[model samples]
Target: MERPRRPSFSELPLRKGDPPYSAWGLYGADDELGTMNLITPAVTRAAVAEVKLGVTIPLDLPLDAIAKPFIPSRVPYEHKLLARGYANDDEIRINTQSTSQWDSLRHFPYQSGYLYYNGVTNADISGAEANDKNGIQNIARKGVATRGVLVDWCRYAKRKGIEVSPFERREITIAEIEEIAEECGLEFREGDLFILRTGLVEKYRELSHEEKCAVAERTGAEAAYIGVECNEVSARWFWTRSFAAVATDTLSFEAWPRKNSEGWTWLLHEVFLAGWGMPIGELWDLERVAEKCEEVGRWSFLVTSQPLIIEGGVASPPNAMAVL
Candidate 1:
């Protein structure tokens, strides 16, 4: 399948009275795949060509890496081994979003209108009947195979002598992201998977057990962390770049406790996951990949991910891999 031309950022909301910059009917009223639709056969083929060294890196953190749930309401993973006469079976229960995950279209919605992508409402997600609209299964069925670009913000920060903490609500501007990509000699392409390494996971590894617990205890406005700015400009940049998906080592892809500056009040979660029907991958394990990119002196690679295929599931762990 060849890629189709999408309307520019300026040509959004496609429908009047919808949220700002929403691509609601771009794919069609009943469209479920969202930006994953951008990953056509040609895009996948181009992505496969990025595999030069045949290095495959796993992008998911261990399921139990975060023993405590950053969101207190979420349950920590539990495991049970069932013993049979000659074999053993294991059963594990997990809060999918507790670890590394992809926030599906059903995960969030436009705050003002309380509607998900294509006007899906809370009732649509939690109604009595079983509805699979905008489920992660759609993404799982399609699978995400595309060219990935690793924007190593940590490396860029070090070289620029900028001091910032991943544990804080520091916002990475779009200009900075463009600069990082330019510095790495990379150009944005439609259907590309934009993977950002903010060193949040690396810093988490340095925290003491007690400190980790304390960090996890933070909730609501207190659970502040570093990530991309969640504003119109940033949203425009992302849409124009035409990234099929985006992942980051931080807890959320956008800055926590979103800052409402310059009249920009909504979170990127609202804009991307809800408005544009884009996926947001968080808590990805990018340490080794970042190092490998630095050593190889190349930033683009082939990336593929298979999301859990739960029919009405909201989110899931991305069984993702990067090939270079």
Candidate 2:
């Protein structure tokens, strides 16, 4: 079968701007779907070969599971029944990013007056007009399914007898991810959904109420989100590898309480989300997926996700599933 055609990786550095990122022109100036363009019909059809076991693993955490907000900016969701005893519907209010969410392009801005993915302005995010500009809905209806790969850093840490802490900012470099891939005998492909498990979610689950409160209080304005390295090395590694999206078992995809150095602070979220139009996901529960991969001697599967079709929304929980 002929492979789906798209712009080559060498075609990147698409924009000549300061951050050196853009796919805006590749799809179109009006394009809301960014790297998602990599997942063509051909890719979707070919992805099925990854499903050999017919087992589906849910990747989303319970909406209300984070009794204590791991991220101070995020607010917990409130649920209310619609009618009375005979009511069959319920209304719920959520912050979209409260749990296991995907950060859309509008989730961040390059600057107050600057543009976002595909040159979308602050007005686009606010729905100044009725157009769907870089919204989560732009990608949802198309279905975000692809070959999903797991990098189980927790298992690797335990095997190496490295003590991993959840309440501290730890940088997982590109070298580490590549090393894990080599050890697992897995190959990364274009448009792959990379799920990185640092075991932060697992560690959080084990924390006592007081411990959780203490951690939250101690890190009042600073959340030591354990995450992937946000340096240029990691940025180049990710872009060059052609992974369409990334989700992590931490609060932020990139290490938080991040020091503003070497432009790393701005580059991670800036380059990935707004600059490159790549989606960032966090708070994914990958415990079972890791266990399954370990048992079956496989770390690659067909992953699928569909965010809520909300217009001009900043973020949404990943309605994600991995099938083996």
Estimate the TM-score of every prediction: 0.97, 0.91
Distance from true location, Cα of 243 in model 1, Å: 0.7
Give the local distance difference test score of model 1.
0.90
Q: State the local distance difference test value for candidate 2.
A: 0.80
lDDT for residue 9 in candidate 1, whole number 0-100: 89
For candidate 2, write residues 1-324 as lDDT tens digits: 443345444565566763355555666676677778778776777788999999999999998877767666656678987776765788888888878889988887665346788777776556447466778887787779898899999999999898969678888888888899999998988888888999888998898888876666655445577888777777778888777888888888887766555754465777778777889888898999999999999999998999998887778888999999
Worst 10 residues of 1 by lDDT: 1-10
Error of 2 at 115 (Å): 2.6
Clash totals for all candidate models: 0, 1
Which ten-residue region of model 2 has the weakest summed lDDT?
A: 1-10
**Which residue pairs come into collision in candidate 1?**
none
Tens-digit per-residue lDDT, 1-324, candidate 1:
433568988888888988877899878889988898888899999999999999999999999998687888899999899999699999999999999999999998998878999989888889786478999999999888899999999889889998888988989988899899888899889899999999889889899989988999987777899999888888888998898989999988888877787987888898899888999999999998999999989999999899999997899999999999
